[model samples]
Structures are given as C-alpha cells and as structure tokens.
Target chain A: MTDPDEAADRRLDANAAAGPLAELFTVDLTVAVATCAGCGNDAPLAAHLLYADAPALVVRCPNCAGVVLRYASSGSTLRLDLTGARLLTVTLAADGSVGISERQPHRPP
Target chain B: MSFVSRGFAGRRRKTPPGRLPPGQYDVGDGFPVLSAGPTPRTALASWDFQVQGQVDGVRRWSRTQFQGLPRESVSVDLHCVTSWSKFDTRWEGVSVDTLLADVVTAAEFAVAFSDGGYTTNLPLADLTGGQAWVVDTYDGQPLEPEHGGPARLLVPHLYFWKSAKWVRGLTLTLEDEPGFWETFGYHNYGDPWREQRYAGD
Candidate 1:
C-alpha cells in the first residue's frame, strides 16, 4: 500500500469545518453550495477542502484552490472572510432532508 | 465591577506557572498536527531549498547538499495563534544565518514559500541572528509530512503560522508582504507575550 501520509493523495470531507461553521449558521452549512469565484465551479461547502491544521480554519475551492471561506477566533471575537465564493445557496435533499444527502442537481433558479 | 452568574465559573487550564504566554495552554507532550492545506510529500531526490528575490543571486541546495551543511539542535517554545503553546520542542536544522552567510542581500522582508503553495512573510531580521531555521528533524525523528517534512522553516518566537511548514524557499522583498494568515485576520506580527493573535490586537 502507498504511504498513507502522502499529501495530494487523499481528500477530506467538511467534517472539520462543519463544527465551527455550525456555531454560526443555524442551517447546515455542509449542504450549502458555493460557486468558486476563481473558476465558477459549483460544489457543496462540504466537498471543499477544509485546511484545519492552521491557526484558523480555511476552506478552499477544490476546483481551483481558491479560498472560499476563512474563520478564526480572537479571544471573545470571531472573524470570517469570504472572498473566493461568488455565490452561496442552500440546496435541499430528496424526501425533504437538508444536509448530508447524496449529490443532486441544484434546484432551478 | 462585574456580577458573577449564579452557577458559572471561568474556564481555565491548570498550566504550570509562568511558563506559558497569555491565553495559552500547555499541550502536555502531544504535538498537534495542523495544516492549512493538504500535506505535500516531495521526493528527496527532487527536493531542493532556495533563497531568492532581492538577493544578489539565487542560492539553491539539493536535499543531499542541505543535509551536509552545518545544523543546530534547538529546544524552544512554540506558541500557536490558536492559544496552544508547546514548550521546549526539539528540532534539528540549519539556521537562517548559516544559509544566508554566503548570499548578499539588502532586502528587509522575506516570504517563506512551501511546496504546497503555502506562503508566510517575515522580516529579514526575524530570519537572521539565529532566530530561524529550516528544520528537518523533530524529537530525533525525520520530520513527518503532516508536520512539514523534508524541511520546514522554524520561527518559534512568533506564532507557528509564521514558521511556514513544508517550507521550500524564501523570497526576500524590500516591502513587507502579508502571508496566508496575515492576509486573513491574523496579527501581522504574532507576538505571544503581547497576545497579538488578530489584526487589531
């Protein structure tokens, strides 16, 4: 088997950013669709790469590696920056479920 | 002049007295692995470290050549912007002074770039006078990829983000540049003692 530690070899879900993001949004952010400003590719916020090893959590667009969102806390204050995302929209799942659903076509309009 | 909640108590860590900087907690031997991007694994045969930009000329070294250079064993405290401070962590690598000894440069700023396109900016003075190193070993083991292996820049005095991991080269500039976190909201100069963890603070 290949070295399990090799980077650029594996990808992670939004589990890392989900917890911190949950505290901010009442709705599940994992199901939200973010259009990458860099390339205009649309993907779920959960499918994006969450670089959690740094001082702050950075969510990057997997398509172009553009930063989609950044969140950090300083003492009692929290800061969030979203410059790489052109648009953010919530997409509901089948059977009226919200998050963690299988990928499906985004709703019309 | 504040009132306390009826059943509330402040959250505090039982840290060893006076050892930790403000708002920091001792991790107690567990060196946490944190990264802003995916870990990069470079082959030693193709790996090289360089110091370029604003210097008289670029300096390059292959993995074998760098390993042959003089190195130092350092035991220093590491303070992360996330309020975690690891004390007396051991590392082995060549100092920035040693690496820049032969190079001629008048630049006052430097941007440490890593293999995975991660970059962190610092002052030229911060990289000199034995303040920083490009380390490859931690705790007597070849540094792991998850923790910036094959050699990562070590600048312990500042927040760990300034010490770019998977560090590959330094690009010096006359003007100070904002790095990954610095461009975000992280303090420009992360001094743990002063608790400069954010841009304003």
Candidate 2:
C-alpha cells in the first residue's frame, strides 16, 4: 500500500520543480553568428562563418568588441569557419587562466 | 602509506585510502540504503538541480543543460563504505572543480541534493584539485540513467555517495549545512578510508 505521507511529499516536490529551470532543461537552443577577428569589421555576421567542433555549445565571439550573444548547439563539438578570425584555442589553465594555443584547434563557444 | 597495486596504473591504499574514488561522490551519500526511510526512484527529466544561497546569481540547469555542458573524460576508482570497489570508471562531463571555479561566492561547506531529494554536504576545500568529475558516462559508454546518466557529481576522493546522482544543481552556503543523511545520524563528512559512515556507530 502507498503511504499518504509519501504521496504528499511527491506533490510538494512537483510544485517546487515547476520553476524556470524546469523548462530550460528539456529545450536545446541553436545559434549562428559571424566572424570579424580580421579587418575589424563592425558589421553583423552570419552563423555559418564561425563554426568549430566541440561538444555542442553556445559560442561567443570573443573578438566582438561588445554585446555577447549566446549561440547554442547540441553536437559533441562546434563547427567554425576560421575565415578571418585567428583560430586560437583557449583552455582553463592549471592556475585558472585562459590558456590560448594554436596547436589545439579553436573550439567555438 | 603502503599502496596496493589495483592492477591499474594507480595504486590502491592498503590502510584504507584517506580520499574517495572519483565519479562516485554524486549519489548523495546512498544513506537511504542504510536507513529505514523511503528510497525514491529518480525519474528522467523530473530532476531539479538548485544553485542557491550566497550565490551572486541564482541559477538552475536542467537535464538538457547538464548534458550540454562541455564534456570531459576521466577514469577513476570508486571505493564504497560498504567495502566494494569499482575501478576504472570512465566519466564524461564538467568537473566540480571547473563548475565552481568561477563562482566568487565563498562557502565553508557545499551541500549536494539528489533526485530522491537526498542531500550531502562537503567542505569547500575538499572539492578542489581532486579527480572529481560530474560523470555522465561509465566504462567509456553512456551511463545508464539508473547510474546517474546525463550528469552526477564525481568526487573520487570521498565515499561513493558523496557523488550525488541525478544531480540538479549546487547551493552555495556559508554555513556547514547538512542534508537528509547527515540530519538522520550519518557521518557529516563521510570518508571511506576512515570508515565514517554512521553517527558514533
């Protein structure tokens, strides 16, 4: 027999999980943006230009002076068009700093 | 300390290693198994991870986001308080060290809540630079959901349950907050080597 108290506890848990993060967990977003690391163009770019391979990600164009928008994907890695931007790989250093390298391929955010 | 070769590159502790196995701490203590209380079956997509208390911004990530985070590969041995050991567990996901690295908030303790709503607390210092990973894979394959697939906190240095499974989120707190098991007379900081399982058992 199911305990009434256990049933009540389940109800309370159901209510608590109905928050914003609830909806956010199931949906995956995909975004596309442009690259402007070279020539320093300030115009908006398309997603096809900046793609890299890494687990699906929300890429941010670090070269963009301001306005960081999130481009989301679910793939194991991102695909980037390294046309103008110098594809530098950045990793969290042992000391916790951004370690940039040309050896490791640039991973889109 | 005498180390016994566990047939892997790493040596096992003969005197009961002071630290826990990686990828095992995410189950939130598994304390229910020892108690007379109810053990809840965690369902898919019904789990919630909370990042609250003393955090600059309160945030929550769902199963999708948990899976979407940068995936990492780590191999670890899991040592349980019950005296069974599973070695060479392969895990994939963000490390607890990486996940909490940027948070500016300071907390003496960190409490992890699991799907069954079970909880476990650990020291802030204990979470740094260990072979811990929020494991989503086991044995180089996608972890079966029953084994905390999608995501689970991995603290290899502590008891397996400290790695809470079906992990929803982390809550940053200044106080040393205790959760379900700790409140019910389990060890506050469960170290397998020390055999710290029950309260004054």
Candidate 1 fraction of reference contacts recovered: 0.66
Residue ranges of candidate 2 with Cα displaced over 4 Å: A1-109, B1-48
Predicted complex 1: DockQ? 0.40
lDDT score, residue B100, model 2? 68
Per model, how many backbone clashes are there? 2, 37
Per-residue lDDT of B123-201 in model 1, one digit per residue for the tens? 8999999899999999999998878898899999899989888899999999999988888877888888899988888
Which CAPRI category fits model 1?
A: acceptable
**Candidate 1 lDDT, A1-109, residue by residue in tens:** 2546534434455556778887777777877888998899898887887777566787888777777888876557777788878999986666666745555433211
lDDT for each residue of candidate 2 in B22-77, tens digit (9 for 90 to 100): 32342322322221122345555765455777777776656677667677788776
Scored by CA lDDT, what does every candidate get?
A: 0.82, 0.51
My TM-score estimates for the predictions, one after another, are 0.81, 0.50
Angstrom error at residue A103, model 1 = 7.8
**Highest DockQ scorer:** 1
